[model samples]
Target: MFGPEGPSLRELAVQALSSVEHGYDLLAPKFDRTPFRTPGAVLDAVAGALAPAGPFGDGLDLCCGTGAGTELLTGLCHRSVTGVDFSAGMLEVARRRVRPAGGPGVAWVRGDARALPFTAAFDLVVSFGAFGHFLPGELPGLFRQVRSVLRPGGRFAFPVFAPPRPARAAFWTLLGFDAAMRVRNALWRPPFVMYYRTFRLGEVLGGLRDAGFGVELYPLPEFGWRADGSPRARLVAARRLTPRPAA
Candidate 1:
């Protein structure tokens, strides 16, 4: 659901019909007004959890979008923070929104996540609401790229919410949404790959492990739990393994 300031149905239609980059460019100015932006609550929860693990030197926000996660990184990282994305339009909005102010140094880069430009240059990496843009097959390369940018013992972290149960209304809604997206991609060009159901936990954990990350899940207690006592949300912290030399 969008607020009054959010994009109209006609506007959304225009975006959906365009390429991902162009679509986001059109949506950039009002991205925060939509449900698409990472919520402040989730950002605060991640920042709180990261405090103990960090006081990190520098942080990178992969696929940073309008830099909501980068804003959070400014608090956890000590030296600097960089927000990277392929969309020039999104980066432009991010640059304007995240002015170099409270704390850590800030920089914006336009690049693809599949081929990150740095090697072991960051101590922390975070992402939000951008996973849906990547297909399941792209996870390995994407994770590898993130790992390549992080220092030894550095972390790549992100929050994930529990999937809606089949009995729930939200379940049907998401299922229908993903189904529609699949149909759209099958029928369209330059396929937009956003799908909520595609990023399963098991597959993601395996992908992270394959990409040389020692992964762990931390429950976010602020959101409480489901009736079955499972956490409503969790933070996935994946540490890049120290490389071993060949014999």
Candidate 2:
């Protein structure tokens, strides 16, 4: 258990045994109390980074579990904000919990991210701490889904933290977690697929390019730089390229 309000260790074990959707459903109520929720600091940094290009029209928060990113969108987007996720339980919680004053209208939709429901609708799309649920092979399709919903020249953005150095204890911790997950999935039915190391930055940029995005990366100076002098966190801003006019 993380704390009195957080899920007990037994609940986490049960959730780990369940499929991703069902597991999230079971955890949705106490999810924010757990360490898994995206931190407010991260959300604030993202909002600050995005404010310059924004006051965007419509926005979509992909896989918007409990509306952390969706809440941030209210301040950035001008017209409307939508949060979509496959878990109804999460959406229910998001609907009741997130209510920002004097911003864009908000809506919660339950749907799969890979096969998104809209086409060319939103001016901006953002996801946070959700990429690890997807496998590496799913990146192309996932990026395409994000691009498809974006208006011409619309942006799809997310933050990626610098991976821990190999020598660091954090690195081994993540490695061990991934290894345990692999073994768990290998033995369990309806696998809970969450792996931290699979989503590499280079592969993601390439996937965005293949999906017709003009990708850019901006350092989030709030997190400071790593020992190698690279940023500790960077926001990936992949804009959907406008189609050329017919000659």
Candidate 3:
């Protein structure tokens, strides 16, 4: 339960127990009201980080959810913007709620991220808050799919925050959440399949390399830095410069 307009505890419980697609279908209407939605500040920061890279052509918001990332794309892409997700309910809410202010026309597609239905069509592809739904074993195929849809020299970008240290309460909280989800999936059918710790940065970079993306990280100064002097958040800017296999 995130707020007065957010899903109730019982509604969230029902969602967690359901299939990932259907769960989001049930939660879609209030998703933006929930903390699960990508925040406006993060969206603005991502748009700012990507500003110089753009005046891009057609764009795709992979797993766009309630369209926060889609809204972000409107400001960056020049021609058209598309939001793709497997959840019809979520897409329905996105269609009704989010509108592009000025840039490209908007389109919504209902499809799984693993098999994106487009070819080398998009100049930029961005995703937010959807990686946790994918298992570690799925990274190569997933990255390949993202790469497949991007044009030559196109970019796939997303922001990643550094994990909280073991000494921090946030670490324990996320660890506990992942543990509980594992137990729940072990006992339930059609697993929800979300894990906070599975998408390690090294592994992700490796997968991107294997998928043929020349990867780079830009510091998101909005989140400042860790005590170790490393960035607290980094924007992953992976570019597809040449042809590649389908993974």
The list of candidate 3 runs beyond 4 A from truth reads 243-247
lDDT of 2 at 138: 90
- Name the 10 consecutive residues with the lowest summed lDDT in model 3: 95-104
As for lDDT, the candidate ahead, 1 or 3, is 3
TM-score of 1: 0.97
For model 2, state the Cα shift of residue 129 in Å. 0.7
Which parts of model 1 have CA positions greater than 4 angstroms off? 245-247
lDDT (Cα, tens digit) per residue for candidate 3, span 1-247: 4889899999999999999999999999899899888888889899999999888999999999989899888889889999999999999999998786677999999999999999999999999999999999998999999999999899999999999999999999999999999999999998999899999999999999899899999999998999999999899999997865799
| lDDT minimum window of 10 residues, candidate 2 | 1-10
Who is ahead in TM-score, 2 or 3?
Answer: 2
- The lDDT, on a scale of 0 to 1, for candidate 2 is 0.94
As for candidate 1, its clashing pairs are none
Candidate 3, residue 75: the lDDT equals 89
Instruction: Give TM per candidate.
Output: 0.97, 0.98, 0.97
Candidates' lDDT values, in order? Answer: 0.92, 0.94, 0.93
- In candidate 2, stretches whose alpha carbon ends up further than 4 angstroms from where it belongs are 245-247
